[model samples]
Target: MQKNILFLVTGMTPQIITETLYALAVDSENSDKWVPTEIHVLTTAKGKIQIRSRLFNDGIFEQFLKDFHLLNMRFDDSTVHVISHQGKELEDLKTLDDNELAANETCRLIKLFTEDDNSKLHVSIAGGRKTMGFYAGYALSLYGRAQDSMSHVLVSEEFEFASNFYYPTPYEHYVGKYNSQERLNAQHAKVFLANIPFVRLRHALPDTHPLKMDGYQFSDVVEQINQSNQNLSLEIDFTHKYIRVNRGEQVNIPPRELAMLMWFADNKVKGKSGIKAPTGKAKGENSVAENQIIEELTADYLKHYDDLKGSETSIVVNKEFFDSTKSKLKKHLEKKLGVELAARILPKQNGRSMPFYLPIESEYITIKDNFKDRLVSIQ
Candidate 1:
């Protein structure tokens, strides 16, 4: 069964909720109606009070449903979500920290809704503070799938922000003060739902991305998405026995696996073609060229291994050891970095039973023998 969800963000004016609901389900202009199975609103603590008092306590929401004869929509106090930070619901978005909390909460709710494969989310950014609306729309763009949609409710000029107005009623319902006023009828008000077009980046995120997990803030998700677009780079430190990706974090693998990676990186930097794998044979068992290649690679691997261990020991780099080390290194990189990034740096074989070489461009790979600090003299 398809679950149609109506999600919104609001501030002082809770009327946007009723107005949006009217446009979606009651208005005759909306021929293709989307009557939500459930409605959820994200707001501050103060906004929640206004919604409760004006929409529920005053029976405005109930009256609207009765007037339109709509049914089966689940919305109540539980669905009205208040933004919180550090274990307290925010009273308002008055400070920068409060705004950040609202943004993170918006992202969390959107992520939660989009996770349900059976749910089709409809996000309304027609209410709330400007920043709050922005966060809501941006969060939808980040997590929204093909089934999800976004919109802004457009009310007629006279009815918009009118204190006494909520939604247009079916019968003659007069609202507005009677000072200089011949009262306006609520039935004549026009509400247009403006569908918003957004660039979908949900598919761009990896399946195992942290955004898929809970507790990630809005800024963290944005930073990760931004980092994914950066050019691939590797900083290898022999002394530390780790690789720093994009100058960010250190990734450590087993000493033998690390040595094998170093060998491949070195060969790539030295402008070598894919090198053939060793046959693990004695001098006469393999061809002369194969024997020389095996010795060269084994010696290179041992040199790196000795440096990493801080001493040399009896260790043989046979064909089986070579293949296993390569496999382990690939898995480690894939686990640390994502699959796409790991594929770019991992050694690649051109064809079946072919020589393998590092695929990453040489310019991006930097190998340092030792860490050094530079001191600048002031004139």
Candidate 2:
């Protein structure tokens, strides 16, 4: 963390606390990068048992989390460090500047509580009860890099679904905690889904690896770290290096297919096999017409689409295009060039749809029958 500002926050909501704790837990156990140096949890006199997303008693939350994690374990490494706040520091600070008192007290705690070590990362995960996400993120902004930057994992809503289900009950948000199946389903889908997995911690646990996730992964994290000019000597050993360009780099490139192939080659992920399709008029040659319905539309973006923040139309189109393009592109890159570009898509606008209406294409993450034969050159 570059900011390295030391401070614990008070008066946080229970939801923030829960989410913040989960965020810290992800890399805390056997992580290769991005670990917090020290953390202190604090609650204020004003902030009391405010459990927003609670599925269990506050006393049982910790044990439940540990048990859930163990059950969901894949790679094993048990190490978690979090300290409970004992608000004695705020005893006599009415006379000092609020910000100054916070800073000085934070520093004093760091000095008194921790021994100076070689740890370069420092974070204040405890802050503004309701704004825990913002505070945690802000603290990291002061000193976080992709390799050692600030990150948060939000805790999802769960429930004590009352139904005929098995162990590790599915966690859900019940409209009615105990009654009204129809009303609860209408009010909260979480509760409805959990109804099937009732009486099981399996239902209580959330999905870990989605087909796709919002944050960066092992590969993207490394790339971001390498690219960031963080004023730190961060060295990433990418075995095979190659030149690349973004939309901003005013450079003429080959066809989208070749550019993607070259991208795979540069990234060292293996793209030599190339797209597999019968060439030279072997079979299904006539279907090429359908293969390029949006031929003019090549995949210009494969990384996540930051531009589709609000616009839903472009989001639909971009997603459809990216999925189709990447499905084909990944194959071409892997087989012919040997790498996989970040093959996700963005949203695009449709000229004909009504205002604020997004077009949903049935095809996503699926390639065409005749897509393998498209030939492209990088140079």
Candidate 3:
């Protein structure tokens, strides 16, 4: 029951719209092919006029629908959006500034249509300037979801640029090739829709991402996604007490909290289990495994205290502090990184009796000891 929307980017040639629509809905025998309920065009003012004159005003658009026995095709002037520069509709994209404006406008429209939850967009980049088509496709790559698609239309050379050819008619229709005296039957001209593969980066962005915010530039969005794709690593600056999560901004943590997190991260990198004791252990006995973890954490905590709190100052390490600090560190990490990412650092408590541990694999973790050689280093 999803509404299908055809979003086309075109220049002087608006035939690509009808040709793409025909290939998607009518020409294909596949029952699953998408049939758009509405169509929208992104073009300059001159391009809009061309589309209006040849397709709408001249009755060519309606005639195509009628020929294919289609009903309720929604298209009008309101749907034909003219790219504007500085809030004025552009006559045509002629200069470098005009092309830049076209790119911005194309990106804006693609983002708007993709944000709608009710509509599944089919974006055609087969028409328009080379830069225009690139921006349209790239914009879709940025915001497009699983339901959205990007494509280009390919018409046989004989009729590709022919003035008389739009789409194949149900009945035999003759059309002349562009700049050639010979005429050919439109029915014999083959048309194909090529699906373009793009890396969908929308999944990497949170629902509250800045890209979803209005007035955000396209380049900024691409940069953010590229940063997110870099290998996941934790650069724990013990001196600074902050962790850089996934090449993003640094997350600051207090020295005490950093000690506890580094405890788990260090154990993970060293392939040591976070569980101090086996499941169902006695209440008071210090299991061999539990004691080892406490010893490791004590050494790590003492290093931070000695470096930042003076080597003469002494801090007690026991079950009370360990138990309380562990809980606080988990809660703080979760609050800073959100639920999904925190789970990577400190996995959820699985069972009532089972101890929690760092679930992030060792391969993805790096523990650097660059605090002036005061701390143990594990990479």
Candidate 4:
């Protein structure tokens, strides 16, 4: 069964929750109504109290459900999450730290819900502090799938912030001071649900990304996304036999694997196409073209290896060595840089018997100038 989740963030005003629910499931203006199977809320300690008193004690939530004939919906104290920092529930977002905590909590809840493929999340950002709302929307943008949505509920101006109004009631209910009060019909009030559009970046973040982990702060998520968006650059450090990705983290690559990587990088820089894998000559059945390719690749690989080792070595580059080196380099790169990034620098075969070349463009790849000079001098 598909679970539709309605997630909301509220401050002192708990009315927004009911107002949003009314807009989602009861409003005549909403042609495509989405009745939530479950509802979850994120709020401050004070806001939780307000929700308990007005929505539960006052029986307003149950009234709304009964009035609309909604059934099988889940909502209780367990679903109402209070924003906390360092194990302390925030009474209110008084300081910048409190605001950041709220943002983190919002992200944590959104991430948790989005992880469940069976659940469809509908996020409401109409009631909380502006920063909380922004975080809610932004978090959804980061993690939301196709089944997820975000929106703000719009209430009629007179009832927008009215303490007496929760949702437009089904019957003729009037709420105001007895004297000097303007008579208004609850049923006639308008509540419009404005759907928000956001750029979904969930696909951009792989499962291995830090944003997928719990307790990743909002700023950390933003930083990760920013890094992912930036141009990918590969830098090889010949001195250390390691490669740096986007100038971050030194990934130690073996000498032989580094040689293979250098072979591809050198070819990419020289605007040459990829080299084909050597076809093992069983019973001396090697083709002339295969032998030529193996000889050419072996010479290049030996040049890089000798420079890296700072001496001439008797390492033979046959079919087995080439295949093993390529496989190990691919697996190592994938482990260190992740599959998406590894794909860019890894040599990829187009098809059977086709040349394998680095997928990343030449401009983004750089061999250290000093190392290049040394390799050139040795050559």
Candidate 5:
């Protein structure tokens, strides 16, 4: 028989799993209805401990199964995945880097699970931090199959977050309400599963094994999918001072920075070595290559000055302005599009004589044209 897998995102609340299972149980009178054959919880080290202590060890999960007489469900510590960074399991998401790692890890596991031909994954986003829930849902969107689904459990307001309210009891049972700490019967509580509609993107990915897909960052995967759909090409509007990345988002840059970016992009088109910015007094204002760069940058900056900032915007072409603009543009690309993608569209630097140049082929870069903005042939 094919497998039914439940992939749950949780923090200190393993109860969500029981509650979700309960919702599945009550939704059908059939004994084996939506009971998963296997369960996997994505959480942190501290969360795993809490789940083991409050749910598995205390017999809460087993008690729920026994109450419902569920014979097919299975879960254990081996099923609980504690997301780790650099080999050490993370206690909790504490910083921006940790969150990025979590997103990547979640995507990785979701990709792995869906890679199996016989597994239908059901993802639960009812517990953990808002970011965690978002990552879980987004990962499913990227790689989820036709049989896979996403949902959240909605508990009645009184029982919501109540310590004693894991699920509606098969028999009369009392649990304390969060606000007044008043006892309420678990059997009377209302629980429902709200199915979330998500766009399936598995078709956009190349047909490859999950293990072979391991090295890709989450953002790169998204970019590749988007590029495939859009047949990615760059559009720069000097008048607006913004460059459109693919067909999705537009990033606004200062005229000076835009000019610097354009110069490097043009060099790629011309098959010229990227000009290296000089340092200290000796490196200032001499070489034929550097002089040509200064001239071109000044012209590009001035060309956009009236349209971008109007006549009030002054154009400066000194070594200081040139250097600062280049640095700022790199930082902006890295910060906005992420390091993986920035490396593609931004100029690459090396210790060789040609210190920097656009790595993208000349064919993909285009200046302003009258093209209808519809799907034009990527030539």
Candidate 6:
């Protein structure tokens, strides 16, 4: 059974888009396992033009047919069907009933993907604007599972994506200079899975089991450009030149990022046939993070939640009372305060004892809530 992946690509960024395609087209590991097919793009008239231009600009058209040498892997550009929302995209589903429309869209996307010979595995791997990614994944989840079609999502480069970044029509931050090779230049990342949408499809047929894929991240993506000897005119650099790892130079991924890299590199998001992100309570804070602050804090908190939860009271007095207090209300206050605060009064350097507050709190009277929400879990 040959796994034919269907990529749902979007956006006008030539370099990033095509570079992602190259990784899949010419994957080094599991070469025989996952084979990507044509792209099913959903965009406006302008975006449709962008796709046409990408074919010529990024050299993706040639790479797929010639460079990667999937001799039989033919791309019928005419089949690059456009599912216009009529100025109304995915989010606009509020206007239409999703239940009926998803059923309709599934048929439509399948029609776009169907070929003359047979029905190819439609793995969704498109990294366009946020909404593009969202809708692409959403539609795939509906169709891929509904009709037993394959669905996937590419894990875009790790960056701080703002929650409200997905804005209204005419998306912002689109760098439109129309350079084809640009897709080859975009940074590569992993693709995650569709838990909710997939659940819908999986629950439909008990016998039909869907495959899940993870990601693979190569540190030296530019080096991939070097290996292919392809040029995109984009300046690629790294502050941490060394990955602290001696080997795994394919993408220069350090040991820390191996798991994440494998998930995306494996085309798990091309419509869910490979490794993917962990989606459950098991995904501690660090599960969804980069070399960022939140993951770090989440780590700390998870480890020290208990230690930080119990409040402590710090108190100090002259050395004279140290002995009496050590035996006196010390344990009494601890029980009364209901915290870990202990008294540690001592003498001052000037031959006198100085009074100090407890180690943590004044007197634990009421139960305090947990600390504020931080990226790390304070132990």
The stretch of ten residues in a row with the least summed lDDT in candidate 4 is: 370-379
Give the TM-score of each candidate. 0.78, 0.27, 0.63, 0.75, 0.60, 0.34
Ranking by TM-score: 1, 4, 3, 5, 6, 2
Which consecutive 10 residues in model 2 have the weakest lDDT in total? 191-200
Q: Better model by lDDT, 1 or 2?
A: 1
Provide the overall lDDT of each model, using Cα atoms, as 2-decimal numbers. Answer: 0.82, 0.30, 0.75, 0.82, 0.74, 0.34
How many clashing residue pairs appear in each of the predictions shown? 0, 40, 0, 0, 0, 75
Q: For candidate 2, give the lDDT.
A: 0.30
lDDT of 3 at 141: 84
- Give the Å shift of residue 119 in candidate 3: 1.8
Pick by TM-score: 1 or 3, better one: 1
In candidate 3, what are the lDDT values of residues 1-379, reduced to their tens digit?
A: 5678999989899888889988898885435677899899999888998899999888888999888888877889989999886689988778988877777777788888887799899899998888888989888887899999989999888787787689988778888878888888888877888888888867776555656667766665665555545555667766666787775678887666677677666666666665452222234667787666666656666765565456633444556776666667766765565434554666445675665567666776665665564333455
Candidate number that wins on lDDT, 4 or 5? 4
Where's the lowest-lDDT run of ten residues in candidate 6?
Answer: 210-219
What tens digits encode model 5's per-residue C-alpha lDDT throughout 135-218? 999999978989998899888888886876788887899988776757899888888788899998677533442223557777
Q: What is the lDDT of residue 49 in candidate 4?
A: 97
The true-structure Cα RMSD of candidate 2 reads 21.5
lDDT of 2 by residue, 60-137 (tens): 344435634533311111111122234343332234343343443333343333222333433444344334334343
Off by over 4 Å in 2: 1-10, 24-39, 48-57, 70-96, 110-115, 118-148, 152-379
Q: Indicate whether candidate 4 or candidate 6 has the larger TM-score.
A: 4
TM-score of candidate 6 to 2 decimals = 0.34
Q: Which lDDT value does model 2 have at 280? A: 25
lDDT (Cα, tens digit) per residue for candidate 1, span 117-219:
9999999999999999999999998899998999999889877756678998888988883353657888899999998999887888666556566777898
**TM-score, predicted candidate 3 vs. hidden true structure:** 0.63
